[model samples]
Target: MPAATPPAPRRSAPDSRIRRMIRIALRILLFGLLGAIVALLIAVFVTASTLPSFQDLMQKPNGQTVRVHAADGTLIVALGPSYGDWLTYDKIPSTMRDAIVAVEDRRFYSHWGIDPVGVARSVYVARRLKAEGRRLQGASTITQQLARNIFLSSAYNYGRKVREAIIALALERKFTKQQILELYLNRVYFGGGSYGVDAASRKFFGHSGDHMSLAEAAIVAGLVKAPSHYSPSADPQASVDRANVVLDVMQDAGAITPAQAKAAHPEQVQFAPEPKQNSVRYFTDWALAQLDTLVDEQTAPLDVWTTLDLKMQKAADDAIRANTPKDLQGALISMENDGAVRAMVGGTDYVTSIYNRTTQSQRQPGSSFKLFVYLAALEAGVKPSDPVTDEPITIDGWSPRNSSRRFLGDIDVRNAFALSINTVAAKLGQRVGFEQVANMAHRFGITTPINTHPSMVLGTSDVRLIDMTRAFASVSNNGNAVTPYGILKVTTTDGTVIYQHDAGEPRVLVAPYVAAEMTDLLQTAVNTGTARAAQIGRPVAGKTGTTTSNKDGWFLGFSSGLTTGVWMGRDDAKAVPGMQGGRNPAQAFAAYMRVALQPRPVEKFQTDVTLPEWQLEPDDEAYYGNPDQAFGNEGAPQEGDQPAPKEDVAPQNPDEIDDRGPPAERPQRQRQSDGDKPPQLDQKWLDGVLGNRRQPQPQEQPH
Candidate 1:
């Protein structure tokens, strides 16, 4: 009672102090609550606006795809850096499904669009492991994986994790679990420039994803965990170990029996043949470059179906690889007149380096570009028999000389073309209008830059290898210029028809009559010109080009059903000394064409019904000296003034090829480097045809 009385007298100060403290605490708590409310509102607004649709990203358009083959299910070339196309969920392999599920989320099917338990367990495990000084681990479900690949950066952070969650919810709302899983399967990286499972399967195993074996599926799935770290093709043991881990997880998750897991373990990881080692490395590399200019990234396929005849290609590749000088380089291309890429070889190897001298290098075409000049002259009513001078002439201080500086004063147009006389081409170009010749080349599908100067007649203009192939195709297609393509159809993941390649009516760049005359000229070259090296037993026509200093050499030719061109040069435009197109490139072309025609009937040239006026003058000088006398039964041309030939000679057919078999087989080819060993003129390309399915180890691509 006494203590209470004393407290009562003096308790006001204590009571007042208590009240002040309580008020301050309340104010601080209230402000924190207000701040949190503002932050929450901002976050909600930002998330609402920042969220994106998964479909939009999944559908990016690619343009003007150069398929390098027909739509009939062949693929020789692609348009983008990624060598792949998209596929749908139904085609996914069960092995891949189980493997990924076991590794990424054991209870994925049971989760209700989200896996809270998985996340919690992962956090717990992560903490335990951290305590034990181990690496961190994840607990992402398939939906989460899809969310991350589709909408989030690969970088790990708390903020990104939260965003991934929000996006995962959005994805769940838009697509079912199966659909999400499908997207994840198709979108995951599998190393080796492959973006999706379909591409991964084709690129690594040379087959469809649906056919992947359990071991293959495990390897593919394991790559998702650490693509560079566990790429089987690059690091076999590491990849196998990761695959084993996948098997262990599958066993733990009851996805596979222990026996199944053990059986699925890889004894050795075998990779699909790398392109660099392909016999058609140069051809493929060149075709790929052209496809890049034509097709867009999103629309290209994982497996490009090409116009290449695998059998023919293999033969050509083998012959060239066996015959070419080990240190020199060469390239070859083949296609049907309808723009189907039949075969190609950039160099001995295509894996380590992909620089295709055939398409990318702009070395002089030598005599190859003369086809257009001769064609343009034919269109101008210049007869094959007309004589022209092969004497040296100067244009803008540029004097043109022949490979052998001796001029055959008066030679027929056919003989000139066949012999690839530089002087005659220069003289003929002056009469035909340099611009007209350039335009004719453009019409014939020479999409590369063509120099309008008089030197254009000397093949001085830069031309890509594919463009040359297509140009030659015109002769085979009866004057129709057919654009080349590789992919036949491209569909979205949901089966929406994204693209279907359809051949348009032929563009008549030249009259069939003119094509016939051109064909005859090329035939003459095959029969008697430098292209003699290109002669096959069947009726074949081609031109051989050996530029000045031997910087570049070319052989462009065709048969009734197919057209092909070969190019040989250095990447730096350095002269290859004595190496000419007829040496390796032309021989490769001949080798490929020979086999390509074996399965089919021998080709026959189709001569034009209407022949141009034939002038029997001995040389261009004689024709120029007396233009009136040189007129044939058709008399002088009815059109513009007859432009007399300068000091030059006649046009000739493709120089009759030596019609020789491949150069005596040089040293047997070892497994060539993946198209990376300095563009060797190695032999193993599509044996000689342009369109051959690469026998991955041995089996065909689709089989």
Candidate 2:
């Protein structure tokens, strides 16, 4: 059937003008679309150029960071630049220069501004990657990248491509091939807050670009592909593998000999973590706070000079926060006698809250305030062997009981203060005059809303951790109370000194001998008393304090030159389960002191710094008389008796209650001393304080 169709030759048909017209229309349509795209690119460039200059993307020269040098300007923290000091081409190590050239663009030096062969290879790769739905990722020339990062608008479109090409050409024209390459090397961003080879060099290798090793240079060079993904500082082993790839590329390009490349690749090159850089973040924060305060928040910014030993700060914070328990949060403050806060930790993790709890939270002094009691007592000429009565004495129907409710018949004052005997302190407060004790605390820098009542003997008034710290620091400074000044010397970004710290002559609240005796008592507290665990091998002195219900736990201590305060508790005022000042705060205090004293010359407090003429002898009569037995001896069901908690409420460690409470809200109980007593026992007071068992016998236990 098919053979019959060959008979007639098909007539040559005339061209169909309609079809030609359609072809013509199609061509016009393609051209129109091309023209539209080109027009859009031109418009984008014109608009972008008029907008903010791309130069703003590069760093500005505001000098935000002022290099706080060591006494020798040893580059503690670079004050201004986002990265580090710039390095010129000649200063950059040849290994890095070659590695980057080899890895990024082998023909960078030989290409006539563009590498066609590389581009073709890249096009192949991009097409392959695109087939898998890739966005056509890079093989970008350093020049192209620099043009993007420093000059291009970064909109990621054809317009940006056109702009990048123009800038690359412009750069090529403005500088020699080597100069352009150098600029590219210096302008590329590296992860870890670094820009340029110089910054990347120091940031990754802990050295300048001039001294970078080949392995180190390769690591930095390889980072160009994906700084965040490939940074050596983030993952060293992975970076090393990438660096080895760069080394092989360099060898292939003949940029370095195989032997030289092999020699450059170390067994391993680790990019050191800048732990100390952020280690003193607390100090940095404190200084920055001062900066904000001293000058306008926006302008006239002050540069701060501090006695901050960043390395020591790191060590101190690291040690102190190491053993932090799950139930507790701790804060630390380290200061010199001159009121310079050298180190601080706001909380367990400052990344969580920048509150700087060390200087902010105002907590009760507990027994730590008892130091002032001893301080005032010694100034009043009380001897270490002085004795006070332990018997239950009613000061207008209010009886302040001992911690254990068992009083020794007779004890010396020194032992009394060291052992934290509450009744002995109450009796001593009566003799020393509670007003005088309050006045002594004032001279020692505890200027808070101190009630100036008998309770002041047990530190019931409110005082800040910073203020309380300053009080101890004052004793460390030989009884010279100085308000802590974290800002040492403030300067403009240009290094002009604007404000400096200088607290006047020492305000001696207690005589030299009196202060020394108190210091000796504090030392005993560490050696054998509540703060025993905080002993720092050296002759360090410390006192421990806890607010009621474990809301605040404290340990304040000092070495020969430095004083530190540590507090642990819940931020929300919820009790810390079962914490005690001597339990964890003391442990943290000792650890921090150990690290802080590493570089210092080991020394004890000056024997003559503040020697108290008055000795501290424990009062034996005050503590050791059993309370249960005493009450039982007086007959069990007296009409005016007290009911103790059935569950005992953990015995209310008078030490914990000594500090103004988190739970014992309302005005704290007054002391049996100073003619002031726990408020006159009205029926209402008894009902609330000791639940309504008017029969006055122990109530049913909670258990």
Candidate 3:
């Protein structure tokens, strides 16, 4: 009786607190399950809404192929829309399929497009590497990569990643696994300008994808990660190493035996010979770079008409190949007076080096920069016949010497320029403030930064060859500004004009008289100065530029209707023995010009001497009126009164005066601490009227 009563009281259908706790736990579990179910439904709906239809997938637009042509419609090269024969799933060998899966996506068959395990691992690695300050690595699966490659840009971010995941999941749900794999294999890039597995097999092994061996398949699979870095043609050993990795992965995945992988590891890969018709590859590359800028959006195949003259391009390429030194590189660019780039040779060989030196490289212009200084002086009322003493003088601590280390007592400004005299140029730069000279250069289309340093007059500042050529073109076109242009028009395959260049009226850069005078002076330089070798059978105006240690040599000149510039230098900036602007660069220019000007009629430069030559009157009072002024002492002697030679004058050769460097074994003066400051002219010499009235004393003679 006692036991029954206790049991009945104790049960009491459990305590109130325990019962309430159980009810609360059940409610929470039920709500959580409902929430999770709703979330999954929403995810499925969103992914399905974003999925491309079967028809949309089938009608996916192929990448547009851009075909670049010369002005005359000669095809230069073609890029993109490069697809091999369509590969079906059955045609793909198991080795090829498994190799891609093993290396690119380990859980391809098990995961639903996105692998959570792989994502977690990638997050951990990315965080660890970010803390160590390394470049972020990717954890993209094959499906994710395909989605980005086909539908999105290569930009990597959380937003893009999320979108990529959604698209990948949608893609997996819409297509069969085999179908997705077929699409990926057909769309993957395999380097050497190849776009698919079949194309890659043909390019690397000179065969079809169906006939590829296990090693070949592995090699092709490895290139999907980085085509250029693992191209068998460019770097065979790197391709082999990457292929070995793929083979190991395949063996681990049970697709291939360990013994089979070991046997294929040491096998040599035979690559096809690269095509020799890629002569215009560099030009095509440059044209492609400009395509986006020339057109807003390239939605279809484009027919781009370039400014290239095929005949001139061939001549320039041949000249550069035949004349350039074996160890050095060279570039040549020829353009019309209005800045239409006619022929451009970016380097000695486009296959060996893809850098466009004509448009990309910046090097010291050497004496070629003197053209700007002389032009500035002319604009400032300094005449070609004006007398300038070429004696050794020190500015602060820097004393620049001529190549011969011998100074001419007095010479006309024209002769000084023809001989590329460093001192006369420096003095002229000082007389007309360096700022004015820099402004004048900027007006003529030199975009490089110019420092207000005395040495800048001697061509110490670096400049691109194209800009320098444009500056000279301004002088050739009678003071008109020239803008260098390449593309003439771009048309889509549907005959719609995407871009058409309108050649506008040339802008005047300088006064017509100033241009004529500069042209005359440049003519003298090519006729009798360092650029003598650049002379063709016609009248030409050009300047020779040789940098210190013979590191860079340039010949920038213009004929009546065409302007061509040649640059020769080593890529490493190492000195080329005995190299000068008048040597190889001049010869190459002459060779190219001879052929380029063959079909065109020779035109003469218009000699319009409207500006009168500035005259200096010989008077003790008016000439020396501004004795305290640093410059603007206009009344120096005209040309008649010859200055007597100083006692310790050294004989100099006119031929050697054009050298930019000092004589062999002669030490150059230490550059002044105030080298950037303008060199001060001696007022006493200006007062003495260039040593005509009395003996002139230099402010500071060179040691």
Candidate 4:
């Protein structure tokens, strides 16, 4: 004790103070190490308790993926979790793997999941950036990212980081580095509604991940940070820039040589073509709306097979874009005679307006409504050769004028329909009774309300384009009723059928003979009447409809067993100057059919009845003005027929608007001199008269 006291007395004060400080620091360090160990244990316990089922994470996605496909199995759009083929580590291209590792975590191979050096560097940089008023950057390694993507929510916080680190460490113990990497690549989101590198590779490169080039691999690897922002389809320039950064990182990480990195120009990458017809969204939306009705609760992924024909859809979109005027909207719906919808374009731009004019909008069908009136007359035993006066007539107080303002006084029922004579349509509606006309419309699939007003004969009632298309499809289907459908089948990924379109026995809507007669009249209309613009060098039966104010122009026709309807108008129903059914609408129909029908053989309308060619009549206004001086008294009302009412609205003046074009554009009927032969279906004369007699291509077959 005396020796120790002497030694302590001789010790320097500074040395004693330093020893005390060292002892305190050692104690503090020891406590800190113990505390960290305890905290890590607690984090491990909590993370393990909250971890997702490994089997489920490996086999099942969180949400069901709904893949909508066109009739030919072309992918239209993917709705939910989009995962491609599960690629093994070997199946993944080495370039793609290296690019991901280089960009995401340079020390991925050397680190044991939780990279302390990377974490320290990331923390330092984040603090430095935070002090400069920047957003904090994360230090998630590839293992951490996989853990978060598969097992944890993407919330940034200290607790989430702790959990991610614990999970990452556990993943490192459970799987090899390559296994972790394979899982990571298969689970990452790569934008464009795609998930996983393989899906993204196919989506962007039109091939699997195994075939990716260096540039493509870099581009795909760069998509992980901010997928939407770096998407090649959304922002090509940004994607290229980000991909170059990935290449630089790869070179720095020694995954790629500098020369190789420099040679890999992502800007020159040829990405897959963008989806052709955005109009397919319209059909997809429609099909999805009916999905729940078709199947039970969607608990698993579904593979939907829709009736949409991609080629026909593109053709329809192109036709509408080419023909629709600026600021005006157009809609088209095409279907098989059996009512399977082949194509639909709701508007000029779907992103601008999603309101489906084909099914949602109801507009007056104009003279196209005459289809029901004429059909009713035909059902009532009126022959196509029956005499019908196109002269001015009033029903109650409504006086309908011919579009040309000058009527062909004594034409047969066939020519009357071909010329779109309003007076004759009105007289026929009255002759067969408005109730019968409305009944015929309902029978032909007009679901909207049809007022039995006298003026309704000129298509005053509002109808949907789909309804009109379906009605015409019924006529094209030899009088069988049609219900328009878009979905062919819905199945699961395992090839289990969920819903199959049951094309049940068609309901007989009209007599085949009556439909044939109406088809003949419609053919005559297209061949020599207002709808000559709709000619496709084939026999087509259709009608033209122009509403009172030119607010709606429509052409509903059928060729080669397909029925299509086109409508042009403003959403506000404002008049479009000089708009007519036989003009833009018919032209659009022709344009679409030119492509839609290219794959099909020409089909003639099958009918037992044929109309004999009529003798040409001169414009004898004086002879037609006097009813008694007409060709025959048959043009007058028969026994028990209702009397024609006096004119209420004055005959449309020469300047009045009509379903046909302006007065100046009206064709002048060549006067047949007393000694001249009757007019024939002269090709040159018809071309000069109708101004549109060109033949388009053939027909199309639905896949």
All-Cα superposition RMSD per candidate: 18.5, 15.2, 13.8, 17.5
Candidate 2 local lDDT, 1-703, one digit each (tens): 5665557765454556677888999999999999987885565555445534333433433424454543223445554445566566787788878888888877777765556887798889988888898776666676777678766666768877876766665555545776667667767778766778888877777777778888888888889888888876566667878888888888888888878887876447756565543435656666666665665534344455667766657766775568577756778888888887777777776654556677777776666778777776666556565676556653333355555556555767766666676666766766666665665566566657665444455566767777778888877776655567655666766777777766765444434445566777777667655677788778888888766555677889898678898887777878665566777888888888888787788776544223323334434244322211111221121235443111111211111212111222211221133343222213333233323344433564453
lDDT tens digits, residue span 1-703, model 1? 5655444455679899999999999999999999976875565456546555546545533423434443345554544434355555667778888898889877777775469888888888988898999866566767777778766777878897777766665666666767778778877778876778888888877887777888988888889878878876677788888888888888898889989988885656567775545655455454454444433554434344445566767875676576566566667677776676766676666654567655565556667778888987876667676778778676654566554435668778887776666667777787767776776677677767776666667676677877888888877787776677644454433445545567875455655556777888888776655566788887787777666556666778887588777776667766565566666667777777777777687656764222223523335332222110101110111133233333233322112111111123311221233442222211132122222233455454566
Would you list the C-alpha lDDT of every candidate in the order shown? 0.65, 0.65, 0.74, 0.78
Better of 1 and 2 by TM-score: 1
Q: List candidate 3 segments past 4 Å from native.
A: 1-37, 45-60, 151-153, 277-279, 607-703
lDDT (Cα, tens digit) per residue for candidate 3, span 1-703: 5665444445455587799999999999999999977875577568768777654654435777888889899887877755677678899877889899999998999898899999899888988898999856558889998889877888877789877887887788878898889888878888877777888888888888876788999999998888889898888889999999999888888888988998885358777887775446666676678778778866677898998888888998998988898889999888898788888888987777778898899888888888889887776666666788988765444456666445667878876776677778878877776665665666677777876655667676678988899999889987777888889888888788878888785565555556777887888777655677888988888888887667788898998689999999998888776778878999999999999998878777654212223322323232222111101111111134232111121222112221122123222231223333222323343223222243333765555
| TM-score (all chains, Cα) for each model | 0.54, 0.51, 0.80, 0.56
lDDT of 4 by residue, 1-703 (tens): 4655454557889999999999999999999999998988776666656655545556747677798999999988888866788888898999999999988888899997889899888888998898999867557899999988877898888898877889988777667898888888888899987888888988988988777899999999999989989998888889999999999899898889999998998889988976654788888888799998889946788999999999999999999999998889999999997788999999998866778999999998887888998887876667677887777776775566544446667778887787676678778877777866776787677878987777677776789999999999988987777889999999989889979999986565555656777898999878767787899987789988776556778999999999999999899998777677888899999999988998999888764224436525533242222111000121223234454453233221211212121223212332233464432223343234223445543553344
Compared with the true structure, the alpha-carbon lDDT of candidate 4 equals 0.78
Q: In each prediction, how many residue pairs overlap at the backbone (N, C-alpha, C within less than 3 A)?
A: 123, 46, 0, 3
Report the alpha-carbon TM-score of model 2 versus the true structure: 0.51
Top-scoring candidate (lDDT): 4
**Candidate 2 local Cα displacement, residue 468, angstroms:** 1.3
- The TM-score of predicted model 1 comes to 0.54
Q: Which consecutive 10 residues in model 3 have the weakest lDDT in total?
A: 627-636
Task: Evaluate model 3: give its TM-score.
Answer: 0.80
Order of the predicted models by TM-score, top scorer first: 3, 4, 1, 2
